[model samples]
Target: MTPREQIGKQAEREYILHGKRGVTPKNLAHKMGVKLSALSQLFPTREDLILEVYRINVQEMNREREEALDRALVDSGGKPLSIESIMDARILPLARRCIEPHKGVQYQVGLSRFFTESSSIKNRILHEQFADLTQRFIDEIERALPYLPREEIRRRFQMTMAAMLGVCGILDMAAYGKEPARSEQEMWKMVHDLRDFLCEGFSAPVQDRHSPSSIHLNDGGRQWQVPLKDIACINADGDYSRVYYASGGCDMVRQTMKAWESIL
Candidate 1:
């Protein structure tokens, strides 16, 4: 590793292992066996050093998450990922880390504070960088949901991430093993809630309840009537939905249900 990289790794190690209590250039310099002045040359400010350490750490974490996703996908034998499997692949690992070894708690708390509290220019830049990188997880979800339109994929992906992040915050609280105390039951509730929320979108609708006669489809600016008995099924394709009926198949309409009603 280059001198710069070596400095970052050492800083991350110190910060994670003991920096939670407190860490300063002098303290880190002492730990690195370097003169304070030398360390200062390498990292001009505390934020600079902390951000560097976090940037590296976030990259490593993203890599691990991606690897887990790949493994989950492979294990499924080319099938789309289930909500339970996705949560297991992504959240459970970190949750385990938070309680085990204890260092993981420190690491998570440090990162949570760095992103939420720090207003440094470098911190903001790193924030955006990680946000884009994090979207890769959403891409994984889209892969698992290849049937959904891009717009629907984005909507569901955003909600799913919101739920995931909330769970992380709760896990972080539990890791402290104190204050606003979380019970074991509460943690399990969060897991079940997340699963149910995602499953609502993926699970077959209660009896595919949309009335066939009431359904109106618009395809390429032309309106079509879909009478219940005449219809076979409605399926989604990439960017388009298809309607299969007794007569044959046609691309599904993009109109809203209400709008379809208005036309009728």
Candidate 2:
């Protein structure tokens, strides 16, 4: 590889494996079998390299999410895919996309940590990019549930996204443990259950008792109802505390509330 390309790929690996915490010039040089001076010449500043690595990873992740979203969209077959279906599709490929120990998920999680702690200028830019990323799927949600209260639909959408990122935040090697079978099974279960529950909540009528838990997506099943509290990882206060409490970066729940306030 050319020097720049080599540096770029190595930088991505380093940052994803370590995030802002992982590596220094000396470590990077040792990993890449180069002199520290040579690495410094290539990377200049650690932050600069980290930013470049983050940019590359975000683009790659977007591509993965898009591919999965497209598959779900195409499979919608003239009908709309629900919010859960979209999320299920988005994170499924991560079984492959997130293969390297705690690489991809850690990068995503730690960057979120960094982002929330960042200055307003940086956080605002991060929020804008994040909102734009979720906007297309949000539009699809709007279309699928036309009569739903628009602002509530969007707030729930934001919470659903927070749930999505929460998985990415916590899926670590240590968390996964040694039993690959158990970890994979649990992760997959998490995906399926959350999708089914949230999609129903998203597609439900505001006052309706029916929920995704009561319905089956696979063969036309009978309609049923579940409590809203049962559908979310919420607290006694009826807010999305479980997910937000675990947010490694920005406060998504509070931000969603702020977003709803702005619109209403």
Candidate 3:
């Protein structure tokens, strides 16, 4: 590889090991067995190096996803694309990457920097790459479910992506957190459950916003009503419960699980 490419690879490794806040030019230089001045000469700013690493990683991920999609298509022998096939090609690989050691940490690190970084350049780079990947997946999904409107497909795709990312985040925390380590089988089960949940969500008809069943909620001083069917799930937390909506909104309400169950 060229010197610039080598620097980018080394920087990515540093980012994975130390996370966004932990990585620095000086430490990266030390790890690379080079002087700070040499590294500075190659990358004038730390952000530049970070952006390069992000670009390389995004390109590599896209390439892998494309190859997986191709293999799935070939394996089907010209049969109609199923949601399971598309998911196998798309989601499972990402879950594996998130669970794998060292290598998968690259994804976690990239996602962290993507959200936490404030630089306009960084945001543009991340957003453009993410949008491109999302569009490609949506196009493939359209082929699988042609009957659904493009807007509805996009909405379901966004929700599925959010759930998949949340699973990855949780896995990352479990791997590095104080809790006991989860078995590989358990991790895979979580991923499969997420895939099943997403497939069901994609197949389900869109909920009507004008449904008569509504739940009254109070957020501090503000009171509002939410459609009952819009609720995706509820989690009990002591005396209060957290409500998750299918539209991706969440709220904490002063109600118990039994109260919610009895009301429903």
Clash count, one per candidate: 2, 1, 0
Give the alpha carbon lDDT tens digit for every residue of 211-242 in model 3.
Answer: 44988776457788887888898899898889
lDDT of candidate 1?
A: 0.64
Question: Considering only N, C-alpha and C atoms within 3 Å, which residue pairs clash in candidate 1?
Answer: 218-253, 241-252
Tens-digit lDDT track for model 2 on 84-186? 6676655565434543454545555545555543475356545644566677767777777778767777778877766766655555434456554336456
Per-model TM against the reference: 0.55, 0.58, 0.70
Candidate 3 has its poorest 10 consecutive residues by lDDT at 203-212
What lDDT does each candidate get? 0.64, 0.58, 0.76
Best model per TM-score: 3
Q: What's the CA error at residue 235 for candidate 1, in Å?
A: 41
Between 1 and 3, whose lDDT is larger?
Answer: 3
Give per-residue lDDT, candidate 1, residue 70.
Answer: 79
Model 1: per-residue lDDT, tens digit, 1-264?
Answer: 987787888877776666533356777788878888988898877767777776776666666777887798799886778766765566665554444454645655655655454466445755655576557666766676666665566666667666766666566465566567555556656666666766665433233234434566667788856676776766656556566777886666675444534433
Clashing pairs in 2: 112-249
The TM-score that candidate 2 achieves is 0.58
The true-structure Cα RMSD of candidate 3 reads 9.5
